[model samples]
Target chain A: MKGFKYLRNVTTLKMDSGKCINCSKCIEVCPHHVFALNGDKVTIINLDSCMECGACAKNCPAAALHVDSGVGCAAGLITEWLRDHRLLAKVECC
Target chain B: MPRISADLTFADRLGSWRVRWGIGRMNYIVPPGLYAVGRPNSDSPVLVTANYKKSYDSVRSVLAERDCWILVLETYGINVWCAAGKGTFGTEELIRRIGASELTKVVSHRQLVLPVLGAAGVAAHKVKKETGFNIRYAAIRAKDIPQYLDSGMRTAPAMREITFTTWERVVLIPMEFVEALKPTAIAAALLFFITAMLQDRNAGFLAVCGYVGAVAAGAAGTPLLLPWLPGRSFAFKGVLTGSIWSIIFYMLAGGSGWSRFMALAAFMILPAVSAFYALNFTGCTPFTSRSGVKKEMKVALPAMACALLAGIAIAITGMAI
Candidate 1:
């Protein structure tokens, strides 16, 4: 995560500060240290560092965090696209 | 109250090796339930993990000296990180496992130490509400579990961090190489036959070997030299290495009499295939994201296809000439 910086602003990770309980679950669970406790609120300290693994969103007690997370495999995406277009009857492979 | 041993036998190492080589991958699973690691007692800490044998073995091997209960959730043989991503290692499974194993009856403490990576699937609050057990997200790696437990059940900052060292990258190469075998073989055979039809058998054999080299450079070499590679995008780094390999291959394989079209084709095809394979390796990496891979595919896929097609067309034209 230190040397690698992928595309910017591509992650769907968002936090609802209004619903945040300041549990710091996001801060604790994030592998990339993307979240930080700011006073009484949790803030996205480094959005770019988020790989969207959905740990924060899944563990959030108050349902304050959201992200569309999945495997980042190109072959998986191609198969999904093929399935969507009805080009492949059944697609498998991760 | 099923007692399980913590010492890893030779059989365990062999089994893990077989799985790493892509053998018995689907069936490489341990039964999902509670097991005692190192003569654990009710007062000992409980650690939640996946049912994958590799994951189980890794966790238990590290706790050889510590007395602990391992609560393995059914993940259908998938590793904790991937299974958690798929939600198989989620709250429902944890609750189900806890209830089935009668964990409360066996363990005095209500705290379950979960791998930090598994935080993706589990919610501490929901599990607490459902099972009355608090989920404590622990070390990212099982090797740190001893220290974590020793330090008053607290994970040090180093324990929480994930670092992909050269050895970490190297260990993944065997599986990557195994996965590439079929495709590389097929491509090599196809290239051999096609080039034999166009030129001579000697030319075909050399071309096939060259192509295999390119594929290996992409699939294995790129990952081994990841940090030092030139570009941020894996595709670019692959192509860079690929181009260098292609040129060296051409010179070594006696390209003096090769038509300009053949040279062009070699340059284009080798790098294109290498880039494609390298780009696919993004999925295997620790840091790559779905969004980043999607962005890369959107741009690189079409380009790879075009380059490959053009290279083939030029190769045929050169042969005809």
Candidate 2:
């Protein structure tokens, strides 16, 4: 945990202000404080800090938020890639 | 007791099959679309989830006595977090499942509660646009569901927290050990054989011991002693522990007169091996972030490589002398 920094730029989380009803649901739900409210509008202050957990998008009533979230583990990714490439069977452990 | 017995028997069969064929099947199929539980009424709360059997079972088993309607989306046997990351657990799937199951007719209410972790994949707005159903993200774990339902569907402070207690950490060890066994055994055996050829045949015992110690220090010690360890970095903690073990082994094995080079080699190699494996343990921890892990790897990996190279050089020089 100390040496490795999380790979954060891969997220697809986006906030559309037009769809945002200014609901603070995203703010309350985020474990990483990825969003903050600015005068009835939600903004992504720390996109890189996001683990892509999708808490905000799930709770957003206005449907203004979107993100690409998933397990970021190397083992999980390798297995997924292998399965996708048909190099390995659909197995839980790699 | 009877249910527990049945569950145990089923788990045994699954485990044996998994071991024999090397095909992990613990998380298999789950029926997609909305399912009623315990004769739920139209007004029952709709809980949405991925079609991963483990996730489905965890939710259903927890809510056994309660009446509810489960809306399971097609996640292709992936868990919520992974499915969300891959977009299999996203807005399109939710909308498609809703239409396919005619969920609107099953439930009188328009609100659907989903796992908080599923938010990454699902676009709440898209689901609403397609099905007119509002999404409510629940607490992190399914165990808090009964309380959430009782408390007007509001997540309490306790419910929101994710804990990695000792028991939880311990449970993770088995899977870690299982995953590591193949590589660890192969490496240990190769080292054992090589050591036997280079030195006394009994040297294989030392080699196996060293390899096993490195694995245990990295995989088991780091997680169990996570909070107590001196460093914030897992690799550092592992290296530190490994260094201590190497010193203890050196003292016990009476390797003092062997050479200064071998002493240095032992110190370098053991810790580097431990560090690499410990860094890999980040994937298993809960509090680790993607950015945090990447940063650790950048610094730790180079140090590990350097140490390993230095160790190899020292060992070769000692052997030649």
Candidate number achieving the greatest TM-score relative to the actual structure: 1
- Tens digit of per-residue lDDT, candidate 1, span B1-321: 677788899999999989888999889998999888777778999999999999999999998767899999999999999898889989899999999999989888899999999998888889999989998998899999998898888988778777778898888888888988998899899989988988899989988988988988888888888888866688887898788789888889887778899899999999998898788888788777888888888889999999999999999999897
Q: Model 2: what is its DockQ? A: 0.26
Q: Is the docking of candidate 2 incorrect, acceptable, medium or high quality?
A: acceptable
Candidate 2 C-alpha lDDT tens digits along B1-321: 001110224765464445333255434766787777666888999888888766776677667667888888898777776677678888888888888888888789999998777776676767777789988878778888888899999977655555667776776676667778999999888878877777767767876887688788777877787677776667788897787678777877777765788778878888888777777777766555554565666688788889988887877787677
Looking at candidate 2, what is the lDDT of residue B240?
75
Put down candidate 1 lDDT per residue, A1-94, tens digits, no spaces: 5666666778888889899999898888988888877888788888977888999998888998889898778778888889989999986764
As a whole number from 0 to 100, the lDDT of residue B71 in candidate 1 is: 91
Error of 2 at B181 (Å): 1.4
